[model samples]
Target: MKLYKTYEDLPKIKLPKGQEVSISDSTLRDGAQMPGIVLKVDHKVKIYEYLHNIGIEKLETFVYNDRDRNAISMMLDRGYEFPEVTGWARAATSDIDLVLDIGAIEETGILMSVSDVHIFDKMGLPSREAAEEKYLDALQYAVDHGLRTRAHIEDMTRADNTNFVYPMIKKILEIDPKCTIRLCDTIGFGIPFVDVEEPFGIPEMVRHVKEELKAVNIETHCHDDFGLAVANSIAGYWHGANWSNVTFLGIGERAGNAELEKLLLFLERRIEGFDKYDLKSLFEFAKFMEREIGIRIPRNKSIVGNNVFAHESGIHTAGVIKNPFTYEPYPPEVVGGKRAFLIGDSSGIEVLRFKVEDTLHDLLDVKISVEKNDPRLRAIQADIQNLYNNEKRVSCISDEEIQAYVEKYFLFEPIVEKSMGRKTL
Candidate 1:
């Protein structure tokens, strides 16, 4: 192995850089907003601690609804740590009162529908002026009450940029210049390059808001309506937005928020100095989510999939065996995962030898001769292979069957020949 102090040949980015990228996990808040998804109090604490452990310090637990708010407080009082245990709320004093009742206003976020459709149609408000006044009032109210404020500008993509979007941002910054502003692509309308042109895409929107408002920090809350949530989030980071709201497995309202597992994996690889993210623990935490929360990770999902490191083709397997970096972007060991070889028609003789030698190295006392092309060996191999291939189907085979047929015949065949006292033929 060799080490280098400089990365002279590393790839360079062409886009103008933005702010420091920070992850804000919403596995509890916005994720719970997900239909049919709920975490018990204890489970929420575990997840909260887990996210913090993996270098995600900011956490959003839930909206200001009564049942959920009580649960969040219980978890918070139980000593959940991170940036803070914050609850989400509508941009109304009544909603802020709900957060105060739960003892969370000082550690809360206020979410308002800032887009034209939400302001006009959803809230039945006449115009952006009315919504701006309401938002400013609620933000100032929270601030006056000694609360650290965060505002969600929901559905920024569909909002009327000139009329509703710009003015809303202006008012919020006027109230709290350091207030964390979330540019939500609610309904997932912000695509990276295809649906939107450069310097005006989702990333551009975040950048524009940050610069226009001169807000201390900006956050991105993207949806996957157009399958560009992850791309948009990265672009947001590149363009100076630091914070992002993400959910595990990308689970949320429609398609989902950015998948936390995939999101962290992307950052660990693409962003410099991201080794701070506990890559291995993140995957383990993801597995725990699947086991405890009952949400299974998709097989083709990035980072932690069973097949993410599995190989079967001769060329690929050989390259992986020689050096995992040959075929894999990053070593599986870094993520507490191991590379796997699935032997089938594509396997070459070397792979078979490697597997056989590894398995039989200490168990077998004598060397065994097996031919790659020999018909007899192939038949026995095929027969053995069925046992593995039909593992899912042959559950009906009983212990009695193994004892009466398999153990007796298979184990005794070779010994029987030796004991028969048969001389050389």
Candidate 2:
């Protein structure tokens, strides 16, 4: 059966220039927040080191407000190395000071809500003007304290008033020349094919925002509510985003964030001069997380999942064996995966013979006593082969086909006479 669409024919995307592959692993902060998944200080440091060894740029290890002082202190004391550890925080004077006090201040990025709804309803501020004033105060404070800052616009996708949001962004850029504002779809509400007129849809607003804030950089942090986190993040890059926040395996709150592996895989194919990282270690990292950390790698999950290169049907297996490009966007080996031919009911005689005579020759060589003329022995072998095939769901071949091969090759008589006087057929 045909999938909804082929990966190649889906759409042709154009990635921007100078879009380097940088990763921000949130395993300690966001990934640990998964229900029933928690880590002690040592466990946190271990994962942090693992991520750093594998070449992740930023590691969102913990929050650094007054609320998480002890955890922050312990991590610092443990001499954790690898990733440039950063803390997530609200754009508040006290919160920012708390982060700086705890030594989480180097190159820190603070999230501030630029959406009018947050300003009016959440902050209970009289107007957008007051919120803008507070943001400027926070930005100035961050810059003065020698903290290279990045602003996060919370709930950016659903902001009712881009008229106000865009201006607020411009003001933040003006206050600090080198500041980078992160466009956050906090509620996982952005889409890929958004209309230019849609309210708070990132695709429509990204170009305008980047153009206005040309002096300052732009980043994107999207959610996967509509299964468009990757698309929206790429859209942001397409529209000139300078940075993007990604987590390993897309693990985060709610539907999770854009997966780092998926994002890198996209860039590798779409953007030239972007494949410099050690991608093989990424698959090892994914497996380590799945086997040790207990996070199940979903079958259809992108990049590092188990089924990314598994083929069962005769047609798909044959096509893949002939030319991987017929079924895969890139060779599985590109990301530390290999093609796997799963023997199941749909396997043709050729497929079965390949598995039985070639792959499973050792298992088949186990001697079994049977009369030379006994169709029963051949039937049993065919039945057992069909059982494994059926259980694995052979989608390419029929039972009759496998049975024909078995009857012809497996039912042949022995060359010498046996003690029972049965001659070779």
Candidate 3:
């Protein structure tokens, strides 16, 4: 009866008592930063509504310009209690002031570049000490203004944990005991393996932050440079971090951040307390991102992709026709997706029969039994095979083509009479 099994000797990821998991979205800020992607105020509002409706806990956005400010204000006007709107700013007094001017956001992410590469090369800072002082000054200003801060330690996976990372965090704790710490995997260099050491081991880093440094709140903001953003974020949570930062469709700078839908689906299945989220809205949200937002979602993308629930192979279609769970990890309706049985070169007779029955029910509101050995079924299968074998057909047969075949093979007096507005058997 077991659907899955794992080794009992492996290190288990049990959440500490009184600790709960939450997802924070950065779609509008980081996701919008993808090259050639521009989200106007209206688009921002619509995306905000989608995230809110899905029960996202927090949403971080930029407030440097009037457009960003107006979007934040419009979203705040709705008065949603779950997704507490937050702001992202560099570790500077001016950036902090911009967030403070927004007035209502109680928390903001203060970016602190920790790695020598960032401090020395990217920022051209004279020394690590100077960088630390600058960040602490900005953090102190935010705390003095009565605003809670999330100290986003940029390039954390590549930073010097002993000299820079730990000492800087200790200093931040001295300023505000309750300040949230966000570990940024800016280059997706973090590894999820438990056996790995610091700098790259995500689990080791999170454990050190939670257990050793005794940080109250920790968030994992990861990128997808190595295609391991979601894995690393989950590792952070499993090792003790509470918040998982994500962007819908994983759209962000370069390869993007952790995908919101993928992470949510994983949490929904593996963890408790996530059932309250409207998981069904994820499909619509993906479509909205693709259509209105002009993002092209790959057909094979996980969770919300069009092909996730589609079956065309003979064996797959037959198994699914008998029992959907045979081929699907979960029901499509769980995420507002539909199971589609596609007819193509790989399709079997069972799929053809099911499509005909389904089409009949749709057209005439009647249920007809279609047996496997029916001559009509064999004839239709022959024609389909001939097209693919002889005519070099490359695409799946559409529903319209299937319906035409059904009409040609089966006597449809009932369909004709029903279309004529008369009751028929």
Which candidate gets the maximum lDDT versus the true structure? 3
Q: Kindly report which residue stretches of model 3 are placed more than 4 angstroms away from their true locations once superposed.
A: 1-18, 412-425
* Residue lDDT tens for model 2, 193-258: 657564556766677776755735777788787788888888888766767787778877888888
Pairs that collide in candidate 2 are: 344-389, 344-394, 345-389, 345-394, 346-394, 346-396, 346-397
lDDT of each: 0.70, 0.67, 0.88
User: Cα RMSDs of all predictions?
Assistant: 5.4, 6.7, 5.3
Which ranking of candidates, highest lDDT first?
3, 1, 2
Give the alpha carbon lDDT tens digit for every residue of 206-324 in model 3.
Answer: 88888889999999999999999999988888888889999999999999999999888877765655475778888998998888888999888999899999999989999888877
What tens digits encode model 1's per-residue C-alpha lDDT throughout 298-399? 766667877788776678877777766677877786677877665664555445444444334334555555345644334434554566576643332232
TM-score of 3: 0.93
TM-score, every prediction: 0.81, 0.77, 0.93
**After superposing candidate 2, which stretches have Cα over 4 Å from the reference?**
1-21, 65-82, 358-381, 384-425
| Lowest lDDT 10-residue stretch of candidate 2 | 354-363
The list of candidate 1 runs beyond 4 A from truth reads 1-18, 63-83, 102-105, 194-200, 362-425
Q: Residue 325 in candidate 3 has what lDDT?
A: 65
lDDT of 2 at 143: 80
Best by TM-score: 3
